[model samples]
Target: MATQTANALRFLSMDTVQAANSGHPGAPMGMADIADVLWREFLRHNPKNPKFANRDRF
Candidate 1:
């Protein structure tokens, strides 16, 4: 699941760069796994209310 999540992030990041025809893709690709693990295990925020006062701000 974690690997899948990481790959999905990488793909989306790459796609965004490709669509824009600009920006560096290496950072996103490299950070994908770390971001996935952090989000899954450590980060806490509300998807429905991203700016909630009590939510962790990354």
Candidate 2:
């Protein structure tokens, strides 16, 4: 799941950069794993209600 999540992030980042022809894709590609871990483990929120009044902010 971690690998999949990281790869998904990498794909999105790379795709955006490729499409825009600007910015560095390598940054997101390199940090995907770290980001995936952080979001999955410690900084999560309800996708459907990310701005819920009672939820703690990341």
What are the RMSDs of all candidates, in order? 1.6, 1.9
lDDT of each: 0.92, 0.88
Question: Which residue runs of candidate 2 sit more than 4 Å off their true CA positions?
Answer: 54-58
Tens-digit lDDT track of model 2 for 1-58: 9999999999999999989999998889999999988888887588898887766564
lDDT score, candidate 1:
0.92
Which residue pairs show collisions in model 2? none
Error of 2 at 33 (Å): 0.4
**lDDT score of residue 8 within candidate 1:** 97
Cα miss at 13, model 2 (Å)?
0.6
Q: Give the clashing residue pairs of candidate 1, or none.
A: none
Alpha-carbon TM-score of each model against the true structure? 0.82, 0.82
